[model samples]
Target: MGSITERLSKKDIEFIENQKMFFVSTAPKDGKINLSPKGLDDTFKIIDENKILWLNYFGSGNETAAHLLEDNRMTIMFCAFDGEPNILRLYCKAKAIQERDDVWEEYISHFSTKRAARQVFEVTIENVNNSCGMGVPLYDFIGQRDDLTNLYNKMSKEEHITYMKKKNLVSFDGKDTKLFED
Candidate 1:
């Protein structure tokens, strides 16, 4: 199928992560769908069938979290490594828990850094599929990045949310992202 999910086996998780990058796509009813290429350690967490989590770093815009606020739908994809034939995708609805929320403490602890991570979005995964990513190329894991870490560290809390309001409040398609408030 062009786009679908198959349940993940325990062994599948190890292989799925071999790829260097994964894409996260989100959108609201009438705007642009944000497909972000996420690298480094800021990616997926298979907490359980009904729960997944990802650290949303401060970026040019907070469209991803905003989209989740408007609508819980989200999709994460992992392609195969070394041109192996496999493609995995997970579909779910999400809730973005902000820094002020109590849940932030437990989830963010998994990460080594505590800079401009605005929030951790929790997903209740609905489906998982491992299709053949035979066309996907292989890549090696280099390491984590310090540049992002330093940049986020440089900004104060007020500045971070202010930046978000200006850039992330609405999806490019003119749909409201509801980035700041509940």
Candidate 2:
């Protein structure tokens, strides 16, 4: 059976904290829909029962940020990949808070990461759904990957900004992510 609620319960928060990875989904008005798997530690924070913050790093595409600029609709999903058969989905309205933004420092303090974060997404959860994930296959737990961290550590701040300008400022569909805009 499936259940729907307006706010995250203690059990739901525990499940989210235990997960090693989660998926973020978003879509442009007339272009590609983006679904990304996030696994970096200290990049996710629960603000309250209805709001959460997600730290987004410089990636190949800025689809989520671009989509959020056009439309705030976003969904985050978590699954029990090793233990119980369960899936949780949070439907939300999200906004991208870039490093250049005034409120960046306010939310950035909630996370503890040395990586060059492209933006922080402030997501307000509108609905929560939990379902029995019986059809989902189980996978064993493994340690987190340090390749990205190692690579990031070796780059200078200027290099990081240059990479973001080339890759993180635009979406695959040619939409402006407003990553560096004022």
Candidate 3:
């Protein structure tokens, strides 16, 4: 157990900023928990107390968005490397914004990546936690994954839409994500 201050202090936020990737987890009222690892400059905005904004570049599934509609609870995690040992996790509720949303341009402008990010999730943080990550191994930062970058570059909007329609519309459990239909 840890105190909230011990969980997401300012220094802890700094540590999280250094991470190139983080895991996002969410679930609907009744379904499998969605845990997806995000990378690159897409996962972002360490906003003030009780607020977080993360960009979701194109992915194989829209589990996060789907789950959020059914339920808002979520978790974002960061594990340290090349620095002090700590594991930080933020527990919160989240809302998803589509590209058509009014604030889409405002939030998308924050990141430089050009994947035409599918959604931005604004989280209402409820608590923060930090703990000794004795088991987490230190690794050197290489760079962002170029394969994904090139993937979108090679895809046309029509093709991307088709792919999203086929893969991103539903969770593995056959639950509707409403990402494409939305």
Candidate 4:
């Protein structure tokens, strides 16, 4: 059985804080769904009872930003991979904030990452679901990979932006991410 609530309780917040990784899911009105595994230090934050922030690093795809632009609905899921079997899910609407935006620095300050961020997703939680994840297999977290960050840090600022424009400006479905919009 699962319990649904309108906001995160103390227990829920604690569970989220212990999590090393989470999944972000989004979809356009009518197209492929995007589910991404997000894991990095200081990338997730609880802004309040109903708001959260996810610091998104540049990735191979920009489906999340594109989908959020088309439809704000999104879901974030965190599972206990090393402790008691529990799952926490947040159903929400989200918006993409890029570096060009005025609030970018404010949001970027929330994270500590060497990789250049592609966007910061501000998520408004509409509902929360907590459940026993009995079916999920447990895995030992060896460590966080530094390959991505190291690779990104090798490039100059301009080169990094160029890479993003070339590879992350559009989703696989051809939807524009509005990553460079004024």
The residue-by-residue lDDT of candidate 2 on 94-176, one tens digit each, is 99998888899998989888468888899999999999989889999888999888888999989999999998878999999
Please, what's the RMSD in Å of model 3?
Answer: 2.0
Pairs in steric clash, model 3? 7-129, 7-130
RMSD for each model, in Å, please?
2.8, 0.8, 2.0, 1.0
Q: In model 3, where do residues sit more than 4 Å from their true spots?
A: 6-8
* C-alpha local distance difference test of each model: 0.73, 0.91, 0.79, 0.90
Which wins on lDDT, candidate 1 or candidate 4? 4
Where does the lowest 10-residue lDDT sum fall in candidate 3?
Answer: 1-10
Stretches off by above 4 angstroms in model 2 are none
Measured by TM-score, the strongest candidate is 2
Error of 1 at 138 (Å): 3.3
Instruction: Write model 3 residue lDDT over 159-180, tens digit each, in one string.
Output: 7777787788787777787775
Q: Looking at candidate 3, what is the lDDT of residue 166?
A: 76
- Evaluate model 1: give its TM-score: 0.82
lDDT of 1 by residue, 1-182 (tens): 44444455665667655666778888876567889988766456667555777887767777787677667799988776665577878887888877777777999887776677767888777788777776676676667677876777778978777777777676666666555666
lDDT of 4 at 175: 96
- The C-alpha local distance difference test score for the whole of candidate 2 amounts to 0.91
Clashes of each: 8, 0, 2, 0
